[model samples]
Target: MSEKVVLHYFNGRGKMESIRWLLAAAGVEFKEEFLTKREHYVKLLDDGALMFQQVPLVEIDGMQLVQSRAIMNYIAGKYNLYGKDLKERALIDMYTEGIIDLLDIIMLWTIETPENKQKQLSNIEQKAKERFLPVFEKGLANSDFLVGNQLSRADVHLLEATLTLQEIFPTILSTFPKIQAFQERMKALPRISKFLQPGSARKPPTDEVYVKTVKEVFSHIFK
Candidate 1:
């Protein structure tokens, strides 16, 4: 069955991907309105729905929520993925922020010039192998989750980041045994397992065609 997403963003990873991950992890059903044309973006602007004039603007519970980080936090909190207490939530926030740093590089990779693409990819591999993955690997050293010994927003975001890295660098986690095990465990969750299956709402990796479409659709922003 085709997945119906509930959000406003281009049909690519960008910032919306994290939101998709959270909703999928929660087993929540939603619909997404892809803004492929300038008119689509303009519609949001015209409707005054975008608080900051950027996506991923999400429509849920009769409220138009903009800003990707805010949307993610809201979803995480709503789904009981945030944490059990304030300290746990803070740790989740801290860990997820690091994961976001890794995702930002991947999301920006599509725009890098041919000259810089290889360099960027190399940098990503280095950071993932050296910095990011090690952090998560060690975080999961004592527990399956990154925080509070249970699934939380940090775990969800970390799982999403690992998947994205594997999509680009398939063998990136070869040395990170803990993360490898973590991936298997996270994917086994009924909700996340469903999301990992084919024909899910998950977006594909950014490609030439997607980049071209994005440049045309968001010329003002990209330029």
Candidate 2:
């Protein structure tokens, strides 16, 4: 039986990184259809292919899946990455949702204008240190994984979120030793390790401007 899974997203990782991680970790073979140009995505929207008017659309077995989280959950359910049972699934959702909230803030740094982008970066630094880090630190205080002993979608999501933060705020995770270790453990996974390698499509593009600005803004901590 041939199962076809096609993922549509922008050329960069953005919201699709976790989905890529989940697919790769599950050893699922899929094709990436990059919507590189605005017209490409506009065509899809005009065709009504994207119900939610967004990218990160996954086509599996001829059915279109919209919403990044929904696509991830569907993939996870198929691969058993969601959880062992209902209770575990609930915990997985909780952790994953919390990570998504932090990711939302980090993504705001992508704003085009320098002033707004700088403000977003500052907000990211403040929130990561004050609100997000402590929550994950306590959550992972005992377990290596977010939900259970084994890898779950929550862990995958968290890893993507951490890597995204690391791109701009390189030293942000230093204070959260547990998350630092968790990141290392996730990166060491054989499948995940391959996806993270240089030149891998799963890697997001480096925003040089964002990196320089963040370094300057957080020079005190970096020093």
lDDT (10s digit) by residue, model 2, range 12-128: 556777788889888887788776455666788887888977767888866788998888889999998988989999999988888888877666556346777776778778988
For model 1, the stretches where C-alpha displacement exceeds 4 angstroms are: 1-5
TM-score leader: 1
105-213 per-residue lDDT for model 1 (tens digits) = 8888867888888888888899888888888888899898999867898888888899888888888889899999999999999999998889998888887877877
Off by over 4 Å in 2: 206-223
TM-score of 2: 0.85
> Using lDDT as the measure, which candidate wins?
1
- Candidate 1's TM-score: 0.94
lDDT of 1 at 208: 80
Each candidate's number of clashing pairs is: 7, 0
User: Could you estimate the TM-score for every candidate?
Assistant: 0.94, 0.85
lDDT of each: 0.86, 0.79
